[model samples]
Target: MAEDLVLDTAIRDWVLIPLSVVMVLIGILRYFVSKLMRSSPAPDAKMVKEGQVIIRARNLKSGANFIPPRSFRTRRLYYSNEENGLLHVPKGQGTNPQAQMFSDPNMAMDMMKKNLSMIIPQTLTFGFVNFFFSGFVAAKIPFPLTQRFRSMLQNGIDLSTVDVSYVSSRSWYFLNLFGLRGLFSLILGDENAIDDTQRMMQMGGLGFDASKSLSAEKDGLDIIQHEWALPRFEQRAESVLRKLVK
Candidate 1:
């Protein structure tokens, strides 16, 4: 194993400071790129009505217990009646459950735009770091790392004797890429032009077919166990009275 060597302060001036600055700038740029790429969805009257109806029915199922049974029956009849049930689909109304979701073009378009945003910055950064910041140990964390991270944290330099904790310039940039998010948020407000946390989360769900999301949501809604909240009022009052007396 190579002996440990102290890194110069010049590395801080030339590598660490510069890499940190550039990453923050790049994150802010990507934020705007994503903002410009995002297009607002068009309003769909039918879809809006469908959502409202579904919510109304679900709320009634779990919450309408306090309505007199006759009134509840009437309301349920209004929802379940063969002519105009809220939950029932009309014969020709987008019969394929996933049809609407699959046909929507916005998610695909947004995904492409976001991918471009991520790719451009990453590619540019790789080339930039290799060109200008190669062959120097940039920074070290407070803790130790194993041999596994040595290769990852030192891209251009190759030396068995070098400590794994001493990262190369490019490695420092990559580390700052993911690590300085909190600092970025502090510099640029929580919902500002530099935040990509939400964007990254959106990326995770991007692989899922939009249709599957709709199907999953429907499955979830279908199995909701509706326990009425009002039936235990009399027992509750007695218990409260007993507590007061005690």
Candidate 2:
């Protein structure tokens, strides 16, 4: 077994603390930059109507048992009706996403701004860490970690013999980048733009497909076997009342 390296206190002071502080400061800077660059486009009326229809369908599906059978059936029919229903999008009627993006220059601009805000600072920070603190063992984790954690925690360090608990400065930067989400949330509130993970997920996800979403909600509403619960509740209430009287 490879012995653990004794990390210097100066390494923690100069590399670990400064790197973490830089990451936090960068996150704050990114949040404000994104806020300044964000554009609020007027929502399309049809899109708003479609979104509300989906919300109503979802509510109906979740609360189907609570409402009367007649009301449930009526609500389901309003959305899932084969003809003239809110959720029924005609075949071949879905808008091409590329075309939509092309048609709206403001949307494209907003996307560009978001990308710039996310990418530029990250690239700069990464370069700064690599240039200054590369291969420096910054700190050691308190708990034992498996060998699988080597690549994750020891980034920029080429030494395969080093234990996984020793975190390199570059990896420390990344750890602070992702791990400070809760700290950023506490400082900047829950909805702040400091979360890189959320931004990455948003970048990966397909933007809202209205037709597909509506179709899915319609299918979900159609399959639900709603049973009214009021009668069961009434019986239970009567039983409780009788017990109280006795």
Candidate 3:
């Protein structure tokens, strides 16, 4: 019996302990890497001599999807006038390269593939860690206290920011064992989260109105000429300054 106990202890320390440590490390690394990728700045255009704008209608009619037309739409703003007390652009010359990307089926497919490739690995890595280490960490603690501690970790380190890449790992695990087992409902919930994040990021960082951008009238929205939102704003400011100087 003593010999058996000694062997069991050795196995626990050498095998189980090491495995547990490795798992925890992998999980943490996964989380940080995801954070890095998600937080990477969206492209900026100033370096490349570009401009960006989020179009707002001067007097968009009520209940209408304030957007531009498709075939007649032009990308770059090379026309100007006044209409109904606001700056009016009747017909414009030049075309926006960014705006043109959506109409190309091949380009759209390529973009989607690239995005999915970036998200999948980050998500899976996080999932693996959340599934394996979270439980292991919970083992030493009391039942009632485990959830509370886990919740603390999640809120403190997880969803408070934009890191939604590995949500299936952290958030879904808690949900599944915590009585949320309906697979269909869970999937729908994940989709909603993803959609929400995409919308929020586009609105806040890119100043993009996806709805308007997608409609029959696509030209109405201001074209983001160069890259990200910051440089676009900067470019506009510089243009205003130049006009003042001249």
Q: In candidate 3, how many Å is residue 210 off?
A: 12
Instruction: For candidate 2, give the lDDT.
Output: 0.85
The segments of candidate 2 whose C-alpha lies over 4 angstroms from its true place after superposition are 1-8, 143-165, 192-194, 243-246
Q: Between prediction 2 and prediction 3, which has the larger TM-score?
A: 2
Q: Rate the local accuracy (lDDT) of all candidates.
A: 0.69, 0.85, 0.38
In candidate 3 the C-alpha lDDT for residue 190 amounts to 45
Q: Can you give the lDDT of residue 236 in candidate 2?
A: 100
Better of 1 and 3 by TM-score: 1
Q: All candidates' TM-scores? A: 0.70, 0.81, 0.28
lDDT tens digits by residue: candidate 3, 70-130? 2112322321213321223234433454665666565556555546644665477556655
Give the per-residue lDDT digits (tens) of candidate 1, residues 1-246: 457688899988988888788888887776666668767767668667666666776666666666666666666666655566555444555445345445767756766777777777789978987888888888766678889987798877887778788788878877887787777678767655334566678677544442333344344444544444566887899899999999
For model 2, give the RMSD to the true fold: 3.1
lDDT of 2 by residue, 64-170 (tens): 99999998898888888999999999999988766787788877787887888888988998999899888898988888899999999998889988878888888
